[model samples]
Target: MDKDFWLTKWASNRIGFHSTDVNPLLIEYWPALSPKGDEHVLVPLCGKSEDLVWLASKHQKVIGVELSEIAVRAFFAEHFYLPLVTHIDSSHVYYEFDELEIYQGDVFTAPLSGVDLIYDRAALVSIAPSQRYAYAQRLCSLLKPGGRILLITVDYVQDELAGPPFSVDAEQVQQLFPGMKTMLLCRQEADQHHPKIARQNLTRFADEVWLIEA
Candidate 1:
């Protein structure tokens, strides 16, 4: 998938991936990181997610990187946050209000570093497998030493469905992060009643969460 693919998805409101409420898994497992409430958190491919609001409550600063301007604007508007906007460069725009800041542009080129924690709910599974190594490398570059990543991914038979929520199994997750230590925290079968599964006739779907430390 190309950049315009996501831009179009946001513009046309075909955001089946967008969650209206905070993800339950995030709430259940976030505290496992023992956040001191002073770490800088990064959320990549963050599409106007309610998770940003929840992360901000737990961290000193929560930074989100997204490609779609519509999604960024909608995030602030939906949250009733009037952000100070700044043009970072030809490729990026930064929006900030209190502890929340979002960079609207290419996540790979966004000017960011020294993140203590990275949250990847939708990012990893959303990328094409060929580019996931580069994506993971960029994430490592953005993190501080001893930093951690809270990642959530989906697993299913790829031939059964075309995906943005692609199947990224534990073995691939380990390979993507190469030298980093990966710990699987949860593995649960996908709810058969979930709209995507039911509509797509997905016979086997599972969700997994991991903690990766650098």
Candidate 2:
């Protein structure tokens, strides 16, 4: 998908993929990373996720990169804080509230060389299949050596569906992060009662979380 796809999604309020609360998976799995105070964590395709606010509340510095300006603006606005604006190359930097900073531009173009940890809940799977390899390589380059990456992906049989919420199984994740030690932390069928996925015709859907060390 191109930038316009996401921009339109945000503009039209077509963000069913956006979670209403901090993801339970993140709550249960993130502490395992043991992020230290002042260390920077990268959240790619962050949108207006409350998870960033949750992380920041714990004294961790958060750098979130998003493609949609609407999502970026909504994030700061909804939080009742204004950002310190700056331009960086092709992206616009919005830094505010001391804890969170967002880059409004393509994630591939955002500078991420110094990121301590990568926390991706919706980033990777949201990209189309043709872009997954490039996205993975960019992620690797952005992460520090020995740094950790926390990824959440979905597995389902409905490959025919046109999706921004794409399907990515464990094997694909392994191939994508070949240089890192990849371990599955959790895997369970997504709740059928979940309002978002309930309408899908698929028999079963699984959420798999992986911990990758660079």
Superposed Cα deviation of residue 214, candidate 2 (Å)? 1.1
Which runs in model 1 stand beyond 4 Å of their true positions?
none
lDDT by residue (191-210, candidate 2, tens digit) is 77854368766666888999
Best by lDDT: 1
Question: TM-score for every candidate vs. truth?
Answer: 0.96, 0.92
Per-model C-alpha lDDT, please?
A: 0.91, 0.84
For candidate 1, the TM-score is 0.96
Which regions of candidate 2 are displaced past 4 Å? 89-91, 191-198
